[model samples]
Target chain A: MTVPSPIELVCPAGSLPALKTAIDHGADCVYLGFKDATNARNFTGLNFDPAQMREGIAYAHARKRKVLLALNTYPQTGNWASWTQAVDRAADFGLDAIILADPGLMAYAAKTHPQLRLHLSVQGSATSYEAINWYHERFGVQRAVLPRVLSMAQVESVIANTPVEIEIFGFGGLCVMVEGRCALSAYATGESPNCNGACSPGKHVRWEDTPRGMETRLNGILIDRFADGERAGYPTLCKGRFEVNDETYYALEEPTSLNTLELLPELARIGIRAIKIEGRQRSPAYVAQVTKVWRAALDKLKAGGAEGFSVLPGWMAELNKVSEGQSHTLGAYYRPWK
Target chain B: MKLALGPLLYYWPHQSVLDFYADMAEAPVDSVYLGETVCSRRHELRLEDWLEVGKVLADAGKEVVMSTQGLIESESDLKVLRRIVRQRAGGDAGFRVEANDMGAVRLLAEAGVKDWVAGPTLNVFNPSTLQLMIDAGATRWAVAPEMAGAALAEVRAALPAPLETEVFAYGRLPLAHSARCFTARHFNLQKDTCEFRCLSIMDGIALRTREGAPFLTLNGVQTQSARVHNLLGDLPAVRGQAEVLRISPQGAHTRQIVELFRATLDGSRSPADALAASREWMVEEPCNGFWHGRAGVEQYVAA
Candidate 1:
């Protein structure tokens, strides 16, 4: 067994309670966004406001854990000031680092707060080492959260080349597309994750119950319908079934969550610096359960190394309960999934 | 305003691609961006062939620009990109290249290519990113396809310096790209093992919602809108924001679409007249709602 360097467990915290729960569950760091459209999870009733953000930071810092602020959305032309202000807020709140997607925002943060650390958000759509290095060269980005598209070998190759620390999605809702490059949400609804920080924004969503099934539509575009006693995932555009070549199916991808619990040893062996859990829109109970499971898995890996590590059944069951569609996949990490 | 024929986003027969550009030699377009911007597996026209095609267009009194692939997934893909960058910067220095992704941007900037087109996939929504592109030596940049007219105006107003702006004026809007090839998946084949099925469909295969509403078009890895995004009706507003109007190449009647747009820009034809003339040429319905800051699939008409 090889000596494993401890990898940071970056958990999501949508609220103050989630932040504290993550820290208490042995998260090395908890990442979150603000209440405004400046961050990716700009859903109503989600994310931290200024007071909660300050409180969350204090809670994490007191426990010797890091708090990362995600200002991961691209600022529109007229709204550039708000994103810049968000960067300033992160610095003022004494955040351990700012996870940013926009190069323009990164430029602002790098110039204004020279002391603050920056992690390239997955929304940055940086897949290769060259792209990550460019962000590092231009903005002094210390870490990069890679888009969930690379295979295992590709991930290893990227980590081998770049000095910037690499982070990969370990668990959560799967985005089949390269994060920052997608415009499907904009096509279906005028709002996009890159511009509006929300995909299939709540305002555009409409659900109806028919005698045939339960129907979900976004911007009047019928996304999906669920039959009686059938599981219905959130009607994200990509996950819905569509007809291609006369057959109706999930043409892009199925409604599934990415679970990398089985690949923990391989990820560690490849020298990934951090493992990220994606869903700030979820509940605090979810944060607690996932954080606890991941914490246990990571600790077990640390104790036993690659040769002895194995994912426990209880941990898998715990994660499955909260996974989208109550199912899990390795996503693009496994070559077959691609 | 200038008209540009964007790089072909579909796979076609080698002869058809050659014939298409050969036809473009006589078409009313100011710039022709030549390349395999979608899948790198498409080698019907290699870098050398594309350069040869570029030379043909250049000699025909049209500005030629080569575009790199939007998504680079493998070492071979990067190698191809590196070769394209080297050829553009070194031997084929007469024409410019368009950087589609940040990888291409970094490569172009690193190779000291001073003047290049920042393609739409670079995601330049605000002026700061556009300014950064200018600083990195991009002489021109295309606005992301989803940017409305008001947002475009706002961005243009806030430019750090006068940079050439291009807009996606016509054709099916490319909505998303992924690692897994939807085309291959449709054929029930793995990406590596799939016989190039994208070659069969000159245009991408149509994806409709289960309710049979035309929704998206699935190419190999890229997903596009089922409806063609025609901004010809908004030429007056677009001309105010962008110096060049880009028309993405479609399966058929591209030259006619280019002619109609050219005539509209020259004021020989009214936008409504041009819109009516171009309707039969489009594979799908027309939509300009994205330009109006509405859902892209919608066609909003002002009362």
Candidate 2:
């Protein structure tokens, strides 16, 4: 049997401390956004500005670790020039790769900065090999962040067919809907990951102490209600409980973060190029813990053959402690969940 | 201005879908978009049935176009899209292909087709993106449902002449698409064994708020607005922006709704009169908020 090459461990860094922490904890590459709406993780007071990114990139490069910049949000006609300039700036910075979602931005980067590497953001919504191949052929995107929607078998099939490198989400907040294609956020909040780089935007998110329960609404539309003792997750539209017929249940998906710890061995066996950790909106503590645990797991998988590898229980406990939904699922990776 | 019937976003029984198009053949519409752009499990009418339906509408002197699935997940879905592209590539069918997904766009690019409708799901927000798509072969493009009319006026002004613009002028707006099937989840079943529950809901299933306000509609893997997007009252704003107004199909009164829009666009019916007559045809509250540059669910009637 052939020995599987160790997969690159790409981690998220919302702040400078998080970037340093990820690099210290053995992340091969740290992906972050600017302090504006150019990237998907456009939260308040998170991510790096130009000077901060310049320092972060310098720190990562000095340590022989790579830095990825996300210019992922789709820009409308009015403010598209700003987005284009940001793309050119990323090229000038000499970053490892620029992750993007919009076709317009993708075209600009391909034409203007032909030498820079492009990674298709999950928000690109290229679920199949055919779509992945299109991005590769047209925009010269080197890798695509697979949406959290494919089964493991599907992922293998896509990898076998396409020349583009594969990047799968290893841990963090999971989007139940396909990224980029979803507008449930914008429908209620007038903002989406596609245009605004935020979903269930914090400005529109409000919690009220109702007699029924603690109700969370986005722009005045109810998302989820938590009982007094129940732990409330962040209010995104797809994760909310709503009335379908009569019984109000999670009509789209129950709140659960995707933790693919057990699939690391399988993912490595399938020759996946990188394992991406989400949640740049999370604190440095989260980026540290997630990167540390995944680093250990990947090391374990590499030490032994994939056939003898098993997920350590200690890693599971560490991850669930930081999980948003108070639980974890294999998500669409487990065929039954898909 | 030309009026195009958008592909049916909901799953219907084989007969009802056939009947809807039979009635549409005589309606005052310029083009007909036929196919399952939603879920692949919607097999009441297969690829052949859609081709037959397109033939009927084309015979009635309508420019028929076939649309591909918006989120192509599996190889099987791609196989179906390839067949649709091939059928038209032969140049015998004379059907225009709507590249809803990037996968479909890739296939269209491979076929070296003359023209395609860059579907609303394609997210063509700016003029440069639209221009690049036109360079590839997009003859007409649908504006994103979230896009404002003011933004569209700018994009139209930026673009060179001869490109047709279409807007989602009516229907429950298709807000999102996902791999997980909501309709199957409603019945407590997996997507693999979904039993085609969407067939029962002629229109998509209405998802009301806990407070009993209509919020969103679940159509298989796709989510749409509960309020129907009606732009008849906003005809003054729409007239300059779009050369074609695409009305998405609904369960009932679609033919009448098309005629109302046609009469309004042709100046035979007053905007207020059209809105008044359209009340009975609507299954949900009418809104033109997106065109007025506000929240999509709001009516935003001009003062």
Candidate 3:
């Protein structure tokens, strides 16, 4: 009998409770980060303290679950000490891998603590195989989280060219531009993902009632206006509606999440090492439900029957109920939706 | 420090493009970076026209460099990159190339070219990456717009000697680029089939925040801050840090902007007076926050 290939389910855990919930719910691995600028999700009341991280890693290790530490933000000049310390701490805590993007931090990790495995964060914007290989050859990056800007065909091509394991965004908020490089948030609000670890930061967001309906705004620009009784999506710059000529439309990207539940088999066939679920700020219930659904779908796919392997419609509906905007998109996997 | 005219992000008539450089030949600028760096659909000046203009700039005693498209989305884009590297090989026409993407870096290096400019789009953030590019044959690199002055200082200190540094001293900072065309989409057109609509707005259309505050400018796939970054005052501080100051091409009064930078750099003008004089030449309000390590839109004057 042939052995079934186990698909690694890399789930996000923003807090300790979420980490425990994800591990208990069958996540093969859980990724989390510190509660500061050293990590990308530098939101208030989320992420781990040093004690919490050490305990979280121990708990996951006891359960035979992997823990990946995200130290992904680009370090500010003259202030790389905090990021370097985060890498050192992650190595001390015995993380399964240290996810990093900055070239200096990558070099530091490679030199200071060579034992800790390195995974290139999507924030690195390793779009091409050559770029990925450059990181791998120079810094010994074992795996790379592919940028959301790539297509499935491009992903397959990258996997064929490079020796590193490839992880892709199986589900989450869609970044219209490549991560770490976008300055739209900083240009508007003075805060950016690269510097402040947030985009369209909540402090600058306001929803005002207009004569037409509820108008959603970010840094004082109209992102969307909902009619009476209509739903209002989160006001991000890319998802905002603007008047280009005479008519108003979504100038950048329509509000959507990347849900690739239908393409699991094709992705697996193409030799993808892992699938990443992207909402670390989400609640444990949402994480549990999404993780369980993907786990079931992936297990069924491994059983070799394409029949009866359809993505559960109810699961998708549940995802929409949580935080979907007007709809969900397959993102760059199927087609480029803007 | 010398003056380098950055690629013309705006679309102009064929004659205007020729005329702009013809005027630039007489300007005080030391180098001129020619070609389209925003949208590939802009064909006002193709490879041949750019080369022709490059020859004109070269003959005018300006160091001419050919810049490639910032976003390479298709096989056709790669072909364009290949052609650029081939044309500039072996000191042909005495012109260099500015690689906007890593693919361009590989192609240029493969063509056995020894010297090229690293355009701002490459996102060079650290010393090692900068050194790697330098080793690969980058003689000069325009620091990405968002990198603060403090960061620039660190990279400058770490750079191998003889590598010239340039800063985006004056312009509407080019923030981001993508496959989608915001200018064409403004007219309800698809990217592949959009009519050449970007030509209408010589300076990209201004974008405002929800509170009706001018925030950024949208030019096709490239998003620019609405505030034009005029670092005329910061020139003296960055003078030692950067070898060249890049002045992005705008609609009107570009020659005057170039002259102001040159005069200030040459110590013939005061930074404060030069900054005050720039208000007459800018298309929008001015900002220098990215250089100050603050919000890109916020203007910070050194005390």
lDDT score for candidate 2 against the true structure: 0.88
| Order of the predicted models by lDDT, top scorer first | 1, 2, 3
Q: Which stretches of candidate 1 lie over 4 Å from their true place?
A: A1-4, B91-94
Off by over 4 Å in 2: A1-3
Q: Per-residue lDDT for B127 in model 3?
A: 76
Better of 1 and 3 by lDDT: 1
- The lDDT, on a scale of 0 to 1, for candidate 1 is 0.90
Q: After superposition, how far is residue B193 of candidate 1 from its true place, in Å?
A: 1.3
Per-prediction backbone clash count:
0, 0, 7
The C-alpha stretches of model 3 lying farther than 4 A from their native spots are: A1-7, A206-233, A305-308, A334-338, B11-16, B40-49, B82-95, B102-114, B135-137, B157-163, B210-212
| For model 2 chain B, the run of ten residues with the poorest summed lDDT | B86-95
Model 3, span A1-338: residue lDDT tens: 54425679999999998899889888999999999987788888889998998889988999999999998887764667788898888888899999988766888899999999999998776666666776787789999998776667777888888898999998878887777668888777777777678888888899999787898877666677888887788887888876544356676777878888888877877788889999888888878877877877878787755565777787778667654573677776654342
Q: DockQ (C-alpha) of model 2?
A: 0.70
**Structural similarity to truth (TM-score) of each candidate:** 0.98, 0.98, 0.90
